[model samples]
Target: MNTLLAEPGTLTTSPIRTQQPTGPRIEVTGRMHDRFDEILTPEALAFLADLHQRFAGRRHDRLADRMRRRFEIGNGRDPKFRDDTASIRSDATWRVAGAGPGLEDRRVEITGPTDRKMTINALNSGAKVWLADQEDATSPTWANVLGGQISLFDAIRRQIDFTSPEGKAYTLTTGDMPTIVMRPRGWHLVEKHLTFIDSSGAAMAASGSLTDFGLYFFHNAQALIDSGRGPYFYLAKLESSEEARLWDDVFSFSEQHAGIAHGTIRATVLIETLPAAFEMEEILYELRDHCAGLNAGRWDYIFSIIKNYRGRGARFVLPDRSDVTMTVPFMRAYTELLVKTCHKRGAHAIGGMSAFIPNRRDPEVTARAIEKVSADKKREAGDGFDGTWVAHPDLIDAARAEFDAILGDRPNQVDRQRDDVEVTAAQLLDVHVGRAVTDAGLRDNVSIGVRYLESWLRGIGAAAIDNLMEDAATAEISRSQIWQWIHQDVRTDDGAPITRDRVERILSDLLSTVERFDGDRFDDAADVFREVALKEEFPTFLTVGAYSRFLVDLA
Candidate 1:
């Protein structure tokens, strides 16, 4: 049996015998090393196989529904609260099972990837909750995917620590630690390293969400419960209530299989897509038993709007990304509606990310950035948000200070119901409130998009650009906005109409200036950027194609 174990970066064509009952046969399709065997043990693989076999079809159906809905919207259908679920919203007595263990106070949550260094630092970052992100903040390299699981397993047991190459040591501090809430990759991604052969002899790639959620929950759920924490999660990129329902089903099955109580898992859904913004009530209702709350997720929301309505003409043409502030009528409607819906359902209303990273050398710049972040947090807290997100440790205090003032001696401000905030579908769909497009904005978009793609290809998902920490969300918006502008022939502030030629010229100029640390990876990044941005058919996600082309494990 030991001799049959496959080497790292090599696929095992045969399934290993396990004690579990007959089902899908699990095989490792990538190289297995560095404790990967521990996490991918026969028992764990059996559990994942169970989940994949049970839910993979539903996942595919939901993804198909997404495409159908997008097609309808592009053809002039408007999104609104579903009439079928209207009673779920109108019935004032029902509410979600709120704030399970360690999640009562999320005043200053910090988010980062789950690498060793980030795991240690985020736990000790003095924030109330650390969003141990396996989604946007992480590049799904095989090493990263397995390494993150190992890191989280160790962290839960207080056995995690790190040291720099220069010999500086880091360890978990002896005090109250930030509660861990894992964010798995969206449902669209697949873990190609893991394969499941069904009874029909056909094989399929494992869902990244299930792999991340299953591995972490199987290995650490009981341990976290023993340590007074539950298996908490932040659900990303869900576009409809049906997706939320699917997650709820997964959570129930996982908990029952693990012998944990039915409601042991709690999830905060990110209302990041336009369709989801209209279905917040339905989403929370579907997952009410396992729901913790909803997050504003402004970046992806903007990207989703552009992706869905780019071909709808001038009314949906958005201006510069910078000018599209939360105060804009459309954005305000989205956030306010989220807060109202969450509070109405007896859940927390968390604000969007303050992606500012403080620069020690430039005191003046840091001060200005902090001020802007503080103002944003203040607005959220004032508008009834219970907590907000910050990307760096330095900005945690500033975010906390704002929520702290409103929350006072309270864990959260869930009681502050904004009943006066009545948002309509028309208001939420209004995209004409922001400033017009500009050439400078176009250049910035191309430059940042290229830089982020280069880093992503090099296995870095989060990069600090112009003093702000950017993840895949930022790059998604950048390239998405460019695509929308070209599709609409949007006129810049200088009255120059955007065209494929203009975009190509700008992309070429930006690529020339991009000095990537990863040598030749930039060439691949450039090709991918052009494919996603300039193609007639908009790709669902840039990462999907790029991941298969570059990040796949090689022998």
Candidate 2:
């Protein structure tokens, strides 16, 4: 039970010691650098240990439920809205906690990893909110995990600035900084660098969600409240309303522990999973006191569809990744249902991300990008969405303009009840209505999947592939599509059937092309790609396995 704190400006490589007799003995296995002690204080570790001890078993049970549900779906059981929660959905009088403090006007939000450079630029971006992402946008290297926390702490206090290797300086502006909303990792991932050992000497990895949320909440929740902004969060990859209830309970406990008001923390849930699309109202009900809104996470939504239905025959097979736009029939149903359900519950209905990164040199390409973004935003605004996400700062203007046109002086369009939109489970599951599969599309998937995985292995999560900012969502869709295509023996327009040998050939070709820039990571990325894409059983998430084998080695 010896707890030691490192002095300022020094790294503490030794493991942190915890002394509580009944609590788990928490240890920080990651190498501690400068300022690490400020975030990983003994008190914070104890708090996180309490969180794990109380909730870890429930988390495990919920994950097991996810597996059982997936099994039922694979065995020909159609997923419908849960009969048990029908009353929750029908109770329309209840509403989530409306927007609070800095979250009032989130017409445009820029999302990226919390690297020092991004931290500065995103705050300076004219968008109304900055989704400081710790999930898909960040590699789970120990340095990134700790460094992101440090950068966020500095940013909240307006003490964050960075100098490049060439001596160029970057600083924040004085006024109109975007509101910060942190997104923690999904339930499936674990933070291997942190360990909790029980009395019997059994050791288990810490949950990434708790590790990210606990550290941030412990260090900055009070500071944010003092600054007139409450702690806000964006929940990702939640598959059920029960998971939302778990988060609500965590928020309640955290508020009580921090001496804050019970409903001070506001969270926006991302309706990214296929199952979650069916339970939007129930999700909002579960988190009604803490919920701010729901987002249509398009990329991961598609990924979830593929993961859940890959072996369900040709009816569930999707076309090329590029073919599934927001305007597709099934996607439109999901988005419309989201807006309807959210507005019905008096919660904001946020739109999907526009991943197009502006290319300055090519005016023609830039014009097309702007046009594409403008159309997407306009559609969302017209559909009664309250806000939208942009990956780059440059696309903010286009998104803002569209939302502005629809909103005028209003902060949001949550009052626009989309009663005309009725989405059945059959419509939401309609995946075979989009564009046709093509040989070129298959090649693009292989190339992008390999290239993104290589970058992720090199500790970069978001990579620009062909002018689009691609994150884990991009790679997930790419690899999952490949797996689905091979499982269905899908034939491309070029008259060739998708086989493992053909996919292997494409992987080799892509590997050779990527090897020049990818270095050693190319081999590792290829191995991971083969395992996730070619195996008879699809891996739940590529990052789950890759993080343990590659990123943890960095520690």
Task: Note each model's CA RMSD in angstroms.
Answer: 3.0, 2.9
Q: Each model's TM-score?
A: 0.95, 0.96
Candidate 1 lDDT, 1-555, residue by residue in tens: 221122222323344445322436566768777798879876777788778878888999999999999999999998887898888888999999999999999998999999999899999989999999999999999999999999999999999999999998989995788899999999999998877666565678889999899999999999999999899999999999999999999999999999999999999999999999999998999999999999999998988998888889888888887888899889999999999989998999999996667898999879988999999999999999999999888898899899989989999988878889899999999888658788999988887887888888888889888887788988988898899888877889899988889988988787677664636577787899998888898888889999998999944
Which pairs clash in model 1?
Answer: 8-31, 8-32, 9-31
Q: For candidate 2, write residues 1-555 as lDDT tens digits.
A: 223322222223333334323436566767767888888886788778778877887888889989998998889887898899888877767888978798988899999999899999999988889999999999989888889999999999999999999998999985878889999998888998887765465778889999999999989999999888889999999999999999999999999988999899999999999989989988998899998999999999999998899889998888888788888888989999999998898888899897777888888778888898999999999999999999988899999999999999999988888888888999998876656799999998888888899889988889998888899998999999999998888999888999999999998888666637525588898899998888898899989988888889324
User: Which residue segments of model 1 deviate by more than 4 Å?
Assistant: 1-22, 516-520
Model 1, C-alpha of 53: deviation from truth (Å)? 1.2
lDDT of 2 at 2: 28
Residue runs of model 2 more than 4 Å from their true location after superposition? 1-22, 199-201, 518-520
Tell me the lDDT of candidate 1. 0.87
